[model samples]
Target chain A: MIFRSLLAALALMFVMSTATADQRWQRVEAVTQALDNRVPELEGLSLELPLVAEDGSSVSLSVSFTGSLEDGEHIEKIRLFAPGNPRPEVADITLGPLASPANIATRIRLSETQQVVALAITNQDRAFLTTRDVRVTVSGCLVGGGDASAMAMANPRLALAGSARPGQPVTVRSLINHPMETGLRPDGQADDSIEQQLVESLTATLNDEPVLTARFFTGTSANPYLQFQLTPEEEGELKLAWQDQKGEQMEASQAIKF
Target chain B: MGNLFSDHLSAVLWAGALLGVVYGMIAQWSRFCLLRGLFNRWQQNDSRRLRAFALAMAVALVSSQWLAWQAGINLTRTPYHPGNLPVVALIVGGLLFGYGMALANACGARSLVLLGTGNLRSLLVLLVLGIAAYMTMSGVLAEFRLWMEDLYRPTLPATDLTLVTAPLGLDTETGRLVLAGLLSLALTAWALSSRAFRTSPRDWLGGLLIGLLVAAGWWITGVLGADDFDPVRLASLTFVAPVGDSLQYLMLSTGTSLRFGVTVVAGIVAGSFLVALLTREFVWQSFTSPGHNGRAIVGGFLMGVGGIMSIGCTLGQGLSGFSTLAISSFLALAGIVAGSRLALRFSVGSSASH
Candidate 1:
């Protein structure tokens, strides 16, 4: 009987150890898979993000693309993916001819330390890729309870300015108010989590032609602020529309004289 | 439709000029000094100077809170709050800065005034402080700050200490305002009741004016400076980054945009010069020894690094942060006082030594 009991104990220990090691390996594999999946076009796109963000919510991100775009051939879209997030898509923008070749700035939310991927697609349908490892130090998004959602919502504001000269840089600024909720937050209880509902996309147009676009994630501020430059051929009306996960949308239009 | 006055660029510039004049006038009147307040309390039995500072803090807290509540302004959006606690950095940085302020015999804002009055020592300190601050903010010291953050990490959900109290079922905003106001009033009353304090209208006026300047700073950046495409950094008059910013502006005026703090720093110097010259206070001054100059330089560097690390100087954290009623600012202010006390205890000519 004693010999039988010792054999069983040894077997249990071995099984448990193997299971733990397997779990660790799985996590490592997930990280590796995230890194391996990165598209290469990101090499030409300079990404400026904090190495370690003090607040995971509304972390500032600035991206500048260096490669030349021929006439009628522009970056059709740029998509950002955060692998660790429940909903990995952070932001996606479809850039038109009028948009600047090099710059886009916005804020986004991160659920945790994970790989952030940026995929830039040109009008020719060629895709460029970049991936970065971002560590979320501490999250500052969800501080209070039911009131947080209310407090986070803000009235969207828009501003536009540029010189009347053709191909001159026209600056556009847009502000939106929303919590950009990440589904990962605990809902008062340990087991319950808040469902993510946030602004998913934003698009800007100069004279009805797309000039800039953005995809947003929970990392965006309660009132998301974005600043971008466009080189419009001629001055006309600038239209901006934002869409969120709840199917809520807001639009603002401004007439540009220059 | 947009002339120079109506144009956004000109409006901002004019606003900046106006702000500069106001700050200069107030600073000239108040003789505000974080070092003086804390140092006097430590070195002498006098707490009146300290009380005056508390009065400023109380006024700042009540007024700022009132403005936010009334105008629907979110004070937390500013750098003072950042909606995070930053406990370790605040306390540690504050203590180090407080010591340096004492040794230098003034804080950043005070040093600025002293510099205007032909205080050669202050000039040396200001240069060192500015360079050191830049080092900590973006240069060599940044690496160390990052490493330390990773090492002695706290279990804060977010670094904003207000979050701690918010969860405890207290009226977060109201509680803060009331607490600050009561403290300020109590301190002010105590100071004013004393005959010595009552007689010094010049000092009292200086404190009041400086207090107003703190409020003006918030309005400029938070309200008028708000632009969608080229948003000004949400800030007030804090010496650490501002000093570095001033230096950068001098070097790269065309490249970089002018900010409120930088403009304010410039304005203060110019304003002070005008005031001093008009008042027959301007005089050239210089130090005798290279060693003395070196000490001034080192002291300035310490003030810069310490201020950045703490996130404000005596004026920056003491007045601006305190006005916001940020918990981190309070912790930093305490640290400044403690550090100053320690320096006083050790220094040969320290008032306490006498």
Candidate 2:
């Protein structure tokens, strides 16, 4: 029995050491799947993250791409992944032609000390990637183990900036407050009891035509906040719609005259 | 049209400039240089200036602690109290900065004040220092700085001394308050112990007021500077990065918006120039010789690199970082003292030496 126990203990140590590396491999595989199994160049993408995070609930992250786009190619989509969370995919952002390459910033919920990766896909089906390791300590805000608070469904708020000039880009900032309970969080009892209830899909529309859309996962921070630019061809009311994992929807709209 | 003067970022910038002006004026009035304080205390057996610094530290400690508690500001939010300890970089950087200050005869903060007083020598020092700082911070030398930072990085259990009292069953606030209070008391007592320091009213005022300003810096950045949608980066007075930032801002104003650090640096120059004019202390000063110029260049470069590596200069690490009671600050303080002592010992009153 003692010999068996020693072997089990040694196995545990091996598993513990290799866990992070395994997660990293898994992250690459997930990104590959997202890119239709096309291997990325692994350059030009700059993923910025603090080496150590004092807060797990709301850690700021930014990514920028540096390489020049070819004559016939532009970035199609940029995706963020936090593999340690219940859902690895954090955000999927589609860029307009005028959007600056790789300029994206948002907060993420890190389940633990884990690697975050950003993948940028070009129109030519080429991919560029970058990664950063963030160490999350004892959380600075809400610990992940209390009773999942009832989705208060805090009112969604929106701020519109820049003149709504026809054919000119206008910046829209919006937030919908929610606990964003990951299915992996404990519920004051056993761990991994809280069911995930995150703002899953967000869309911005002008004159009932989709301008921008994003799909979020548990890694998206509590009280999901997003900022994006939209160019309107004519005067119209801009609408932002959000849907949670439970199919609950909340939105705020602002009228813009061009 | 966007409003010109009432946004939170602008408010914070203006507050920073005002605070910087006060800092510049006081530093000029009191001749506040840590190297000079050490030199006077060691070589001349005079402790007044050193006492003033100690008192400032005490005041900064107690009041900043109180502010953190009252305002619900997490000290760990800033880089100085980050849980990881970059031991090697702090020690080497602190030593270099200390030694450079000895050779240059002023810390980065004092260099600004001197520059305002028409000291062309300080202008050279500031230029070299700013470029070197930027090199270490984000330019070519950043690779080496990052390598050194990661060489033997160890994460501490807690970010501060409160970790020490945790196992003893004391809560974090209780532990923090007890430790901070005792340290403040001890330092305050030491500052007041010297009768010479007690008699120098200017020194007393300098220490007390500077301490208050340090605490005020926390409030301005942490409280007034905070915004939900677009938060200003929480920081206080640290000359190394700000000096580099100021130089960059002058060149990149059209591309980059004004920030608290850049504005504060500008305020220091403006305030110091105004004070020098008011006090008639402005003089076009230059190096005594090419040897002196060479020494200033070397010293300035070392200070710039060292300050960036250490994450602060004397005032940055010794005063601002110390106010938070971070263990890394203590290590930095020790390294700086050793470096300063080494420089002082080697100088031998040469013309090239300060």
TM-score of every candidate = 0.67, 0.66
| Residue A144 in model 1: lDDT | 28
Q: Please state the error at residue B26 of candidate 1 in Å.
A: 3.5
Give the top-scoring candidate (lDDT). Answer: 2
Per-residue lDDT of model 2, residues A1-258, tens digit only: 999999999999999878765346444567768868777776788887777664467777887777888896867688998876656778998765544334667788876678888888887888887788887642322341223444655678777777777767677777777777665532112244346577888877777776667788767887787776666677877788899887888888999886
RMSD of each: 12.4, 14.0
Per-residue lDDT over B1-354 for candidate 1, one digit per residue giving the tens place of the 0 to 100 score: 125466454455556656666666566556666667666666677766776776666666666666667666666666666333556676778877877776666778777776776777787788778878878765677555444433443444433445555676656665666566676777677767777767777666666666666776667665665655444556666787887877766775653456567777777777777777888887887776775565566667778878877779887888778777666687888888888777777751453231
Model 1 agreement with the true structure over A82-121: per-residue lDDT tens digits: 6665555566676777876646777777756666666677
Assess the local accuracy of residue B197 in candidate 1 as a C-alpha lDDT between 0 and 100.
69
- Candidate lDDT scores, in order, read 0.66, 0.78
What TM-score does prediction 1 earn?
0.67
Q: Name the runs in model 2 displaced over 4 angstroms.
A: A1-91, A94-225, A228-258, B1-4, B348-354
Q: For model 2, how many clashes?
A: 0
Sort candidate 1 into its docking category.
incorrect
Give a tens-digit lDDT track for model 2, residues B1-354.
115458777878888999999988888888777777787887888889888889989999999999999998877656676446788998999998888877777789889989888999888888999999988865678668767776776766676788788889999899989989999999999999999899998798888888888888888888887765766777777888888878876775654457788888887888888889999999999988787788788888889999988879888888888888887778788888888888888862433224
Q: What is every candidate's C-alpha DockQ against the true complex, given to 2 decimals? A: 0.08, 0.04
